[model samples]
Target chain A: MKRRSNSDGKSVKAGRRGTAARKRRPLPTAARKRRHLRTAVRRRTASVGRRERRDQRLARELDDITEQQRATSAVLRLIGGSSGDLQPVFASILASAVRLCDAHTGVINRWDGEALQLIATHNMPPAYVELRKRSPYRPDQHSASGRMLATRAPIHIADLAADKTYLGGNPPTVAAVELAGVRTALAVPMWTEGKLVGSFTVGRLEVRPFTDKQMEIVQDFAAQAVIAVENTRLLTELRQRTDELRRSVGALQRERSNRLMNLEAMAAAISHEVRQPLASIAANCSAALRFLAHDPPNIEEVRAGLNRTVNDSHRASQVFDNIRALFGKADQGRQAVDLNGLARGVLDGLRGEIEDRGIIVELASAPDLPPIIGHRGQLQEVLINLVRNAIEAMDLMTDGRRTLKVRTERSAADKVSVTIEDSGPGIDPSQIKGIFEPFVTTKARGMGLGLALCRMIVERHAGQLSASPAQPRGSIFRVVLPAGRNAATDATG
Target chain B: MNGQPEPQPIVFVIDDDSALREALSSLFRSVGLQAKAFASTSEFLQMNLPEAPTCLVLDVRLPGLSGLDFQSELAKANIDIPIVFMTGHGDIPMTVRAMKAGAVEFLPKPFRDQDMLDAVQAGLDRDRSRRKNASDAAKLKATYDTLTAREQEVMRLVTAGLMNKQIAGKLGVSEITVKVHRGNAMRKMGAKSLAELVRMADALGVRRTMS
Candidate 1:
């Protein structure tokens, strides 16, 4: 208004000067010079006034731009601060739009392709808020939001009371005009990735239409609302994917450990138990022949060689006895067995295998450990199976050290225990109890009888076999057996 | 086949099983070779070996380190003992690695007694020849070091196939002076002929100063 009046006053002055110039043209040269000086002075003063008005207009525009930026940054800060909760974010966005656009009330409605539901409202009257809560709004030509829904564009109503929806007695529009005293309104549709997600609408209580700048401010708020919604959805999706990955990794590790144990058991069954005795037998026979072929016929050396052959033959047959004991009833071959010696024997038998796999073995045998009474061979078989399982378990570890620790100690006055631990991927705690059940092998090959037979042999001797998790990483299997009464009696005697 | 009095040759057997190690020792003893047995490589390594022709009978799979790794360890420690590798579960890749590292033999168990004996005998022969060459070079170096500097120069040029006059010119001496140095070098090195002198020079890695 001020700029327009200033321009009108300057034009009126210019017309008066033109009429005065025509009258003064008939005067002398000195009078014309004085008139020209006066006119020049007046023109300078008018331009100065024009410049001041333009500066004031520019300053006012700068303030409006600063206010718009401040409002946008506040909404952005709220979106960042609230992790995925969209309630406060939506409220803040609608409130800013209403305040920045010089309107009385603002609302954000979520459109689910069928109807628009009011999700957020700011400063809306109680009657209007209650009227919209009764039912969702479907797409209709009479409503501004419905028009925005159909066109997917911003809609502006200059005067709500003169609008057809108000005249036709649309209940929400009538509530807006009579209850809230709203006239001018602006509604902008929110879009996310080319899909219309919702609408942001603000209304004024007086009949003053919103300018283009105010319309743009509403659009900016709608876009920020879209970002908050999309951010929440992506965050939820990422969380779900992380949970799924963790579950699969755990399952794969369990399966691999089971498979490795079974595979190593099969190989150990053939290579160590059977092959060692066979090789020893062959070597003894060859030595015996060489001794007999001596120039003097060294009968003592020859006899020693033949004795070794006999012992190795017995050693070879023990492997079958173990197999039979696995399937049939318990053997009657009980004896006074030192568990420390048994653990050592098992480790010695697997020395080649241990070295081949590059595993470091640490044996901690307690001094003067009380002896246990059991079938020595079956007990040795149990220890061998456990140690073999430990080795195979560690073979799967690619990063950590491959270490096998075999420990023996007297657990009680009447009991001796052997523990074999490995640095490998440990067993799942939930599956620890179920692992000893028959036919529960995780390997693709072989009958899963390794641990089952170990447990059976242990129980037959009145001993207990159990598995547990090791520290840092890996698994441990411990065997506990009763002490030998005969050995104790002999020592006492 | 020199007539020097040599110490008895020994065969060292390294096996994890004491029974198998004893049997192998007995087999070697019956063939009139002195035998030593150890339960592991560490035990064998701790022994102070005598200066005699010796060979090792190594089990491919042992307690601490595999036989292939042991072979490299020995090389790293500058112990050039000949090894006869025996494995119960010999695979082709293991055999290739052992043989590539200069093992005397890679025999899978239970090998024939004859094959074992032959591998042992071959390993002993190779060790004897290696010892002989090393001693021969040492002796040649010692003898070459005893000569005067001019005599050593004459010897290097003589081994390079230079004539007496050319050697004299290269050394800035008269032909007679070069001849005298060459004679002194041959006598001190115990070379029976010029050819023998040249062979000694080559063994000592002598280079002609001129070229």
Candidate 2:
């Protein structure tokens, strides 16, 4: 009975130990559950942070695209507003380039065939403005502006301290740019009509390289600058031509008015000179018939009155015949006329009138003065009218010093000149301006058509007539005729 | 066969231009006629002469009045002067108006000497006969006034182709008294015969309407 009681007690103790181990495993399971909860929270927080970072990146990219588009639109607006005045157009271009590229300075240099003149500048120093006035940079020379102009392309000088073209040159421009703290510069040529007219440049003072966006804005500015330069030159040429045409029209209007006033004055003078002699002839004939009827007939007294009446009637007829020759119907025919012999005939016709007025006429002409081709009667009329006028002009002078000198000379080019000079009161300076206009005369009771008719005859012969004040109180008239094709030339030059 | 003297008619000249007057006076003298020239009509009127036969040579234009006006004035004054008109550059209307005014002749200036002489001669002959007829009428009027109203009636009947007995019965007078009054009237009128007495009454434009 004692061995059965000891085995039951050992079985109870082993069951107790198994119960303790089961309780320890419940504690570890709770700890593992807490660790799994912490891992789930950590994964949720990491996903939220990654989504916020992606949203911020997308926003940044959209802002950069808008900024680039704004710059491109600003450059287009500048080019649209420019009209041909190149100085203003280029200045705006330089300003627009500086603002678009966000650079420190910009300039446009013009090539005037001998020098590079600073046409326009923006944000540049005063020293650079003054140096550009006298600077001459040839196209083949080693210069950033020159390289851009010669190749008609864009040139970039990055890191001015490392550039070889900037070394060992006495150029004031290089030293100026270096002192301005510019580290990068770009130049683009302005071309118009297939020729390089100038160059445009942009610079950065803080040693930064130009981005592609900045280069594109500068290239667009250069293209607009070229167009503006071409328009301005064409506008200047058009204005000059317009000015020349206006001056020519003004001169033609003045000439037309002068011709109209001359014609009216000539008609008034012709009517007044022909009426005086006709009235005296009618009165003398009525008195002669009364004397012949007396008883112790006075025949001798009647005969004397009859003879006087006949002479006055003949004098009136000659005045009308001279007037008819001037304005008769036209019958133009060409013939060869002796110049010297015609001159002598005109002098002889007026010899009596000249001597009665006490005018000493001196005639000097070359013996072999060539025969001229003209109408004989018209030419004689011109010579006689001129000689008669000269003799009459000296009629008021009582002194024996009155003279008329007529001369003919042959020029070296086979032209002929006939000059008539008179020692009368010289023509007034104001009257000489219109001396050839009809009815512009100084003589009392003088019809002023003589000189005008003379000029018309001279012009018809393809010659020229001019007048000037002669030396020492007189006037001179010169007539020039072109040589005939068959006339001999003066060989003894 | 009486030895009585014939009256000479005076010639009157009127002109405006002195030269034309001197010319016309010489022309009139060469024709054996006496002419007195006056510069105007007023000058000729101031020299009033007797009521004799006078011939007037008048210019068409004058300073104060024209020749036609003077001719009408003379007719209104009963002067009985015959006129010959002269002109220089006379138009056709002026010539027609002058002729209608009883002008004897119209002469244009620069005229022939014979034309003036012929015109003046015709004018003088007409004026002399007219003046003689006027004087004879005045004398008959004087004698008729002296013989009373019966003599005028007798003279009128005698020139009317009536017998003395018909004339006495019409005048209510005796035949012997009618013959005596007729003889006195014929003697005053300077008529030599009954035919002359009839011509004198006809020239005076006297008419008797027998009722």
Candidate 3:
């Protein structure tokens, strides 16, 4: 201050504040110097006051910024500690907003599609907490929080009792806040990108309006709320994805087990079906050798054995064909197969076995027996199983004659029927019911799948095969098939 | 080839395989031997087996019982029939098992005709020797049956190399009675000498000391 006073003294001597003790004769430069000195002194003093005041204002602004930073960091630290579990993160965010704004209540809701679901509440009434636990909140913009979410902006209702939004909007939003005794609140909308996620609201029981500073603190923690919502949403989706993966894995394991079991069943069927034809071929071979070596050559018997060999060889291939069909791996040939011709073929194939067992086979064919449309190999298997079963049945009858009667006829209803009647020890009445089940075998060396496979073949061709007690002490197996369109046309032709 | 009328050697063919049985029968008959065919062990057992030189050509596998098992079954029934086993799928263990059970031949099919004939011939030769021993035993039994109890005792003693005085002492009779009994026993047994009498007694399985 003294330096300014001195500089002003020197400038006035030269100009406006002129001293008469040293006045030159009419020197106008001193007056101008006096004017410049006054202007310079005024300007210097004014700038000093302005600079000191500005420094004081800057210090005050720094205090405000540091407090805001500390509050944000406090919320951020809480969010960082509980990213694994978002409930605590939400609780920390709510607590920071309520404490920072000095409010009595705080709530955090997560937006799921169109609804806000209350996940965390601080200082909540028992009634409001029970309501939130039981149901989700579908906001309709009646209360301060609802308006904030609708506008995707911060809403401050200094006094809810006088606010038009609380009075005119949805009743439940206002009713819920009134019941919880919230008289003042500041709600800020939280969002990720441009989409509104949810609202963070701090309420007070007093009718005091929230200060702009408190609203600023509330807005600060809103970011933490948005991040928490995103983290919790991602975590829930991950859990749901893992649950779906586990279910699919379980289904795959069950399907694998089922496939293996089916393979096991097919293998057993193949073994059981293949053994018969092989045994027949072996027998025919031996018989052929014997017949050829007979004295003077028994050419007739040799020819019979040779025919049996051909039949058995065909039967062996048919067994493999039937097994392949069972697995659905190969498409079997479907053709019009004559019941009479097929039965005669099976009988011829099993001629050696029948004769060896001393079973008298009587074959009768009607003049106009219609053919059935079906797979020839599968139908052959059906007839072969029945014929072999009849042969085996008659082999057990020692007291009476062993007779096997295989007959084919066309019924009046355009259906073809084949009946194999055996005069042997009749089937036990109890065994008749479950005789066609797989593994239901009577012979010691059998797997009991023959009749089951036979029934499957017949049924697949849309035919009915059944067993009944025959007159004069025996069992009879009958297979009736519908004469298909092609076969019926052929019959007319 | 013995200078005695023998029933023709028969080859019994027992196999479940009708062709193989027929083939074997034809082969045997072609070689001038009587052949009888049976389908199984039970069928073969039902017939009264021939007492002449008999050979059985059996299949190793059958519906009722296996050929090796049937071999033991024949032994259990006290029937001595030389068996020649034929198989379609014979392994070393089965061959070993068959041969160990006293099978005369183990021929696996499809055997050469000459090999089969040779096996049948060998089986027939074995059965012939067995028949010769059995017939000689029967003759010795017949000859031994004709002797009186005292003469039979004297013959046992004589074939045992007992002196006439010792035979008399053992028989509790006079030396002249012992001499008379020994002469009758020797004549009935058709023994030309003492060694011949010992041989006859051995054939009859009489109680004689070790040779």
Chain A TM-score of model 2 comes to 0.53
RMSD of each: 17.7, 26.9, 16.7
Q: Which candidate should be chosen as best, given lDDT against the real structure? A: 1
Arranged by TM-score, best first = 1, 2, 3
lDDT of 1 by residue, B1-211 (tens): 3587998999999886766777787788778889999876767877998899999999786643567878998999999999999875646888899999999999876777788889999999999999999987777777778999988888888888899998888778899998899889888989999888877777777855444
> Candidate 3, residue A114: CA error in Å?
4.3
How would you encode candidate 2's per-residue C-alpha lDDT over B1-211 as one tens digit per residue?
Answer: 1255765556788864443454455445445466688876767887975555668888675533557767888889987777898764344787898889889988765465666667878898898778666676776556556655777778777888889999989878899999998888878777799998887677665636566
Off by more than 4 A, model 1: A1-257, A294-297, A319-493, B145-150, B160-177
Candidate 1 has a DockQ of: 0.11
Docking class of 1: incorrect
**Candidate 2 lDDT, A1-493, residue by residue in tens:** 2112122333465477569637533336677788558656855775586467446545644554465456545545644554545665566667767875778888887777766667888877877777656665554557665666667789888876666556646364475455455668888888887887788888888667776656776887787777667666766677888888898888788656544543443342343233223322333333345556566656764565455546544644654565565445323455666767877888887789778767788999877776666667767766776676666556434464889998877754656777788887767799787867653432212222457667766665667778898888777888776555432221111
Candidate 1 all-Cα RMSD = 17.7
Q: What's the CA RMSD of model 2 in angstroms?
A: 26.9
lDDT of 2 at B89: 38
Per-residue lDDT of A1-493 in model 3, one digit per residue for the tens?
1112112223444464246425545536788688669758976885786577456555655654576677678667766665468777778778767875668999877777777778788998878877776666676656555667777889877777677766774453565557788888777888998988877888999877776666777777888788767777777788889999999999999768645644544454665445444544554555557657768777776676677668767866976664566536322456788888999999998899888878888999987766687778767767877877777666445578889999988764768889999997778899798776543533212222456666666665667789999887888999988787744444344
Provide a comma-separated list of chain B TM-scores, one per candidate: 0.89, 0.75, 0.89
Error of 1 at B135 (Å): 2.5
Model 1 earns a TM-score of 0.50
* Stronger candidate by DockQ (2 vs 3): 3
TM-score of 2: 0.42
Q: What is the DockQ of each candidate?
A: 0.11, 0.01, 0.05
